[model samples]
Target: MTPRRRRMVLVALIVLGVGSAAAFALTAFQDNLLYFYSPSDVTAGKAPTDRVFRVGGMVPEGSFSRASGSLEAHFILTDYAHEVKVSYTGVLPDLFREGQGVIARGRMGADGVFVAEEVLAKHDENYMPPEVAKTLKKQHEKPTNSGPLPTT
Candidate 1:
């Protein structure tokens, strides 16, 4: 009922409103965030199973395949130490090819295949995605070789 009490109440309400708005914005941003992972990470079971994420690697030689009369395609992505199978039912980018870097956004299926929603290919031979480069560097830096990478 007092003027001072009314101002205090108004300030409290404003603070509460701002806090709620900030919380909402952060939540939305987190939901849209796509994390990049390497084939090694995926093989180690570190990739998210219920949400979309990104996998970056090279399209190994002879790993890319397409069905006749269909847009469906399959490819094996490799980081040299590990590999992942990816399936995409869409037109690939012009830069897409074997032995090239690529980043695929998708979720892993129960059958251990990556169901890609979108595929991004490297622009040039010298260019590689930062995440992919980092992953490859780490793989090479390891002192011991885990196993031979799968052949296409």
Candidate 2:
């Protein structure tokens, strides 16, 4: 092949390779990225239904109703403006209970309930996970059914 023709082919191949790399990166993220939005954000129309995402909020007091020997339980996750009902049918975390901060990883069901595949509760008093502490502080600033949070 002529020198000029060979160089032109090499340049074209490099460009194609770069473009393919970028496209693959984007496609991988689109397929695997899992967003976690807060309950306030979800109520404010920030959560998308098409993709699986998470919702974090405070579990309202008296909102938890557990079935005997069954994992199915009903609860409410709320922000100040609105509340979302959740129905989870799995083992909850040890700290999971009423009047505590929780982050549920799942999608909103067609029936308007947040179907949680995983439920995370607030950690202990002094040794809370950084993420949970930050979220709890944000939720405590607002008032809803979950009232009178413990003071540090």
Candidate 3:
């Protein structure tokens, strides 16, 4: 083949290789991609139990239970109307607290508890995790807490 033809073929091969790599990467990531779902969604059966995913909600008051070790913790995620128990064996975020927002990644157990592989809290701004935002948005319409306390 001529030099020009050879160079054209080489360029076509490089492009095809790059595209194939990108496609493979995207497919692999899809399986690994974790999506955020609210407690309400989980209860509604919208969350996939088999796939690794994230659930975000407010820690229900009176639901946090400390285990013997600093590694294990049990808590509940609530969207006002629904709740799911969560168990995690790892260091929790500093800002993680009851009534605050949290995002836990893991799978649901047959016993109905969420087995969290990791837990994350909001880092900056007024942004809560997407799942928490969804829950709070739903709860906003229902009859709930009146408002913040009236400071003297």
lDDT per residue (tens digit) for residues 21-137 in model 2: 999999998989877776667777788877678777767788899878998988988754468888899888998877777878888888878888888887775554455456668
Ranking by TM-score: 1, 2, 3
- Once superposed on the true structure, which residue ranges of model 1 sit more than 4 Å away at CA? 145-152
The most accurate candidate by TM-score is 1
Model 3 per-residue lDDT tens digits across residues 3-86 = 999999999999999999999999998987878888888988998878778888888778899867578899998877788899
What TM-score does prediction 1 earn? 0.92
Candidate 2 least-lDDT 10 residues: 125-134
Error of 1 at 29 (Å): 0.7
The Cα error of candidate 2 at residue 55, in Å, is 0.5
Q: What lDDT is obtained when candidate 2 is compared to the true structure? A: 0.79
lDDT for predicted candidate 1 compared with the true structure: 0.95
Each model's lDDT:
0.95, 0.79, 0.86
Please report, as a residue range, the 10-residue window in candidate 3 with the lowest summed lDDT. 123-132
The clash tally of candidate 2 reads 0
